[model samples]
Each structure stands twice: as C-alpha cells, then as structure tokens.
Target chain A: MAKQERAIRTRRAILEAAGAVFDEHGYMSTTIAMVLERAEVTKGALYFHFASKEALARAVLDEQVPFGAVPPQPCKLQEIVDMTFVVGQRLLYNSLLRGSVRLAVDQETPSGIDHGAPFRQWAQALTRLLELARDRGELLPTVKPSETVELLVGSFTGIQLMSRALTDRADLADRLAVMWAHILPSIAVPGLLPGLDARADRGARVLASLEERAAS
Target chain B: MAKQERAIRTRRAILEAAGAVFDEHGYMSTTIAMVLERAEVTKGALYFHFASKEALARAVLDEQVPFGAVPPQPCKLQEIVDMTFVVGQRLLYNSLLRGSVRLAVDQETPSGIDHGAPFRQWAQALTRLLELARDRGELLPTVKPSETVELLVGSFTGIQLMSRALTDRADLADRLAVMWAHILPSIAVPGLLPGLDARADRGARVLASLEERAAS
Candidate 1:
C-alpha cells in the first residue's frame, strides 16, 4: 500500500509537470525533456508509466478535465455553471498552464484521432445537467436540452477565446459570472445559479478591468 | 500610380503566401524561406514589401479579416451572422491557413502590444450594427448591446473551435447556418433571418455525416 501511494504521487507530479509545460509551450513545442526537468524525474520513469508522447498528452488532458461522474448533489444548473466557471477560471489564470490550454485548443487533432467521443461527452454532461434542471420544473418547457447545451458550451469557449486573445482580462471569472448572471435567466430558472459569489465577482471585475483598459 | 499598383500587387501576393504557409506548418513552425518558396517570390521581393515576419503576419491577418469597411447593404443582424458563418467556413477550409490561425490566436502578445484596440474596434462595429438593427426595429429594444456583442463574437469562435475539434464536420458552413437558424430567431426580429436557407440545409447534411462518423 505504501509503495502504491508513492507511485501515485509520482504519477500525479509527472502529470502536473507535463500539463504545466504543455500549457506554456503547447504540445508540439513542449519536449519530454522539459516535463522530466520540471518533475525532476527520469525518462525511464516517464516511459515506464506512459509508453508514448501521445498517450502522455491524452493522460494530461484527461487528468486536467473533470470528465468522470460529476459529484451528485443538490445543486441547480446555475450552480453547475458557476462551478464550471470557477474551475475553468482557475485553470486559465495559472501562468504556467494558460499557454498549454491555448496550445491544446489551437492544436489541430492529428489525422485519425477521433475527438468526437470526448466532445460528445462534454456535450452530454451539459445536456444531462440541463435535463435535471428541466425535470425539476426549474426551466421553461420550450428550452431544448440540445440547444441549451450548444449555447452554454459554445458561449463559454467563445468568451475564453476572446479572453485568450486579450490577455489583460485575467479576471475572466467575473466576466463569466456576468455572462451567466444575464444569460442564464434566458434559458434556466431564475436564481438557480446563485448571484456572483465572491469568486465569480472577481472574474467579473477582471473583465471590467480589461474593458476599462480597452476603452482608455 | 502604375508603379504603386505594382507594389500593391506584390504585397497582396506576399500576404496570400504568408497565410498559406502559416496555415500549413503552424505559426511557430513556419519560416520566411517556406513562404517565399510557396509565393514563388525572391527574398528581395518579399523584403521590399514586409519589413519582417511579424509585419507579414499582421498583414496576413488584416488582409484575411474584412475590417477596413463595413458592408454597404442594409442587412439584418441575422444576415450578418450568416455572412460571418460563410466567411469563417471558407477561411478554415484552407488547410494551409488553418494551422497558422491556431498559432496566431495562441501567440503571446509581447509587453505593451495593446492588442485590445482591434478587438474593441470589432466590438464597436458589432455594437453599431446592433444599434442600427434596433433603429430599424429589427431587434428587441431590451437587448443589451454589450452582452449581444459578447455573445455574437463568442458563439462564432465557439463554432470554429468545435468544428476544428470535430474534423469530419467538414461542412462547417452548413452547421453554422443551422446554428444561426436556431439562435437568430431567439434574438432577432421575427421573419428577419428567415428559415435555414438551402445553403444551410446542405450544411446540416454535412454535419450529419460527421456526426454519424463520430457516433459510429
């Protein structure tokens, strides 16, 4: 058990290191050497765990994304949006990881790699969450699950892309919050998503700062 | 005037070549030599036009984006969305330019670059258009210009990001039209964008093919 724990820790460290490097330089630019150096691990250990770079990249993406069963709890769709907003903002703000995200997002999938499964999984998650809201009678009957998912996911990426383009808007959290605050009501139950909590407000404020800078 | 026209032609050729090279090899990986080779222009000719690679990149971006003048015809906001969809689809379809776009989007702005002015200009353009729509009573008076601009810009990028992620969705033009069909009605005046045109329906068929492959 003790040995297993050490192995898990090492793997986590390596994953984190790879993620940081990938986020900074992008996958193509980031070399395995950097990950090893950052993790202070040997090439043998990395190869021992993951056989290839593609496998490692996939692992890093998997680990970074919360793709598995979302915590089953009493939360509104708005809360889910907020949760995603908070988590996504944290990931974006980390100076080391931000670049990697840009790289990952911008990097075209090599030929023959089907990204649909993962993409669908994300869409499904959002769809299911919306369904839950609808089931509770918290949403309008006219709101289609597919459309809502499309809007939420699409808009989120759109904002992120714009934010990425304009780097000074580091406080994307607040902007995201404001987006949800105003737009969520259009599709979801009013007040299902809590008001811009402190963290979300910070995101809004960050966006405001960027806006002010642009105006100036 | 004749000499100036020749210079402009050379500049246009260089911009086109730069975009092609960037699209194929990606921004970081593309070289001036590759661009010159593709453009079939001598180094002297290339230099006579663009001062440096960065300048070339700026020119390429500016040239690709129709930012110089707004369209002359009065079209509904929905029409704008549809036009943008077609433009985006055509741009991404060029495999050579696709790779470079990622790099351009992900490239870190050097200190003091102030890239936001361009983005602000885009937002202002959209805002002005939205105001026009409102004046013509094509949009709801309650619609907020800032939010609408954010949504418009964000959703467009979102579609691009999603299309890039799912490669089989080759009919990006069609999917965008369907998306517009679904979304425009929510915001635009009734009967403005009209139903999905034949072009958009064809796009839907293409998306179906990709979706089918993805599902299988």
Candidate 2:
C-alpha cells in the first residue's frame, strides 16, 4: 500500500510537470529534457512509464484532462450539455490547452487522428449527450443529432480559439452558454426550450437557496 | 495610363507571391527575402510598394478581401445575408485567405495594439453586414447583432482551421452554406426567413438560366 501510494504521487508529479511544460511551450517546443527537469525525475523514470513524447502526450490527454470519466448524475441531456459547458469553461477559460491545440494545427497529421486525442474524446462526450437529447425528443425531428453535436462542439472550440488568440478573455464560458441557449431553442423540439428556461430559473433558485443557507 | 497599369500589375504580383510564401511556410517562417524571391521582384521595388511586411499584409486584407464593401445589388436583408454567406464561401473556399487567417492567429507583434488586428477587421466586416440586415428588419428584434456576427465569423474560422488541419479538404464552404440554411431561420424574423429561402430558390433559377444561356 505504501509503495502504491508513492507510485501515485510520482505519477501525479510527472503529470503536473508535463502540464506546465505543455501549457508554456507547445508540444513541438517541449523537450524530454525539460519535462525531466520540471518533474525532478530521471530520464529513465520517464521512459519507464512512457515510451515516447507522443505517448506521454497521449497519457496527458487521457489522464490529466479532467474529462476522463463521466460522473454519475441524473443523466439528462441538458445536464450533460451544461456539464460540458462548465468543463469547456474551465479548460479554455485561459491558456491551458492553447499550446497543445496550436501545435496540433501546425503539425502535418493524418486526417481524423490526434496524437494527443483530447478533441476526439470531446466529440464523443458531445455525441453521447446529443444521443440522449434525441432519445428524450429534446432535439427537433428534422435535425441530425450528429451534425448538431459537431456544430455545438465546433462552435465552442472556435469561440475558445478566438478568445484565446485575441483577448485572452475567460468570458468564453458565458458567451458559450448564451450561444447554447439560443442554439438549443433553434434545435430543440417545439416546446422544449420553454422547459430549458424553467431549468435555468430553477438553477438560479438553487443558487439563491444555497446562499440563504450559508447566510443562516 | 501605362505607368498606372504597371503599378497595378506589380502590386498584384507581390500580393499573389506573398500569399504563396505565407501558405507554403507559415507566416513566422517566411521573411521579406523569401517574399521577394517568390515574387521575383527587386528589394527596391518591393519596399517602394509596401513600406513593411505588416503594411503589405494590411494591404492584402484591404484588397484581397473586400468583405466590408457594399454588395453589388440592393435587395432585402435576407438577400444581403445570403450575399455575406457567398462571400465567406468564396474567401475560404479555395484556401485563398487561409494563410492570412492562420497568420492572423499566429503572429504576435511586439506592438500589442496591432495584435488580433486582422481578426478585428473580419469581425467588423460581419458587424457591418449584420447592421445592414437589422436596418432592413430581416433579423429578429431580440437578436444581438454583434454577438451573432462574432458567432458566425468565429464558427467559420474554426471550420477552416479544422478542414485545413485535418482533411486538407476545402469543401467546408458547402458545409457552411448548409449550416447557414438551418441557422439563419432561427435568428431571422418570422417573415424574413422565407425571403431568404425564396432568394436561394431564385439563386438556383438564376444559375439554371445561366447554364441554359451557355448551352444556347
């Protein structure tokens, strides 16, 4: 148990160090030497756990990104979309994923493949939520769930890139929420958007209730 | 007259050549020397035409992308929106402005004020079009024009980035047109979307007429 705990600590340290390096300088700019220096680990230790830089980046995408496993909730489609918006805000609210994304764009990679592969996972999460929305009759009958999923994810990514490049503004979350609000109304079944408005109202009420409790 | 013609020709040569170099090797990777070589122009001639690299780039934005200019026809707001859609399609359809936009994102000049200046121009162009649409009463009264403009342009840029990075496919223009068909109705006034649809049908008819004329 002690050995396992020590292993976990070292692994986390390596991930944190890698995150800092990847955020500061892009994937291409980052060197193994720098990762070793940052993590305070020997080169042998890095190699022991990961084979190459690309593999390490894959690990970073898999383990370090907070979207590893879906949490247990009521599993409502809107809830999933709301959760995605929250996570997107957390990750792209700053330069956390900028370097990696920029690197991915600049490199000549094969189509539909990612070395880091965070985007694929993001798309999968969106697809899952969209499927649920379809099942619930939340989406318009004419709308293709897959295309809608792509549009939502694509729009969010686009907004994040612009916000990052231009103002370094963290308001992308709020902007995305507003965008989704409008978009949901456009794509949802005729009466579902009213339900969303009620949901928002309830959310506001919950916040008020929490504050009241805290005050008491 | 001859002197003016020569000047125009020289300017076009420089713009075309600059675009090529910018596309082949990223904006940061290319230099004045490389541009001159690609254009086959003497340093004196290049400098005489464009005071600096940034000046030349600004000129490209002004000349190559005439997105802000008034449309050739004076029609309904929906027609104008459709016109803007076509403009986006033409601009990004063939990688013509792909390098320019990528440069816009990648280049961080020492002058902080000039940063994101290119993207600002893009947003301004869209804002102008949206304003025109609003003046014509084509857009829903509640729709925020600035935010909608930002969303549209931002989403287009994102699609371009994805298409360029992944598939090397330039068919994003068609996809964008399809997306607009679905999304335009959402923000448009109840009566206005049908006008857009009518104009699109008219566009098809016009194209068919042109083809018939050609065949005759």
Give chain A TM for each model in order.
0.76, 0.75
lDDT for model 2, please: 0.60
Model 1 CA deviation exceeding 4 Å by range = A67-75, A93-100, A108-118, A181-186, A189-216, B67-75, B92-100, B107-118, B168-171, B174-216
| TM per prediction | 0.78, 0.79
- Give the per-residue lDDT digits (tens) of candidate 1, residues B3-81: 9898887777777778777765665677899989888888999998888777776655544345223233466464456
Off by over 4 Å in 2: A1-12, A57-65, A68-75, A92-96, A105-117, A197-216, B51-64, B67-88, B91-96, B107-115, B197-216
* lDDT (tens digit, per residue) of candidate 2 on B1-216: 699898888887887778667666655456999889988988998998999887766655454345323334454455445544554444544333555665554423223325366667777766776788778777787778778877776676665555454445354544455456556766788765654542323333434454687799
The CAPRI-style docking tier of model 1 reads acceptable
What are the DockQ scores of the candidates, in order?
A: 0.30, 0.36
* Lowest-sum lDDT 10-residue window in model 2 chain B: B106-115
Q: What is candidate 2's DockQ?
A: 0.36
Q: What TM-score does the A-chain of candidate 2 achieve?
A: 0.75
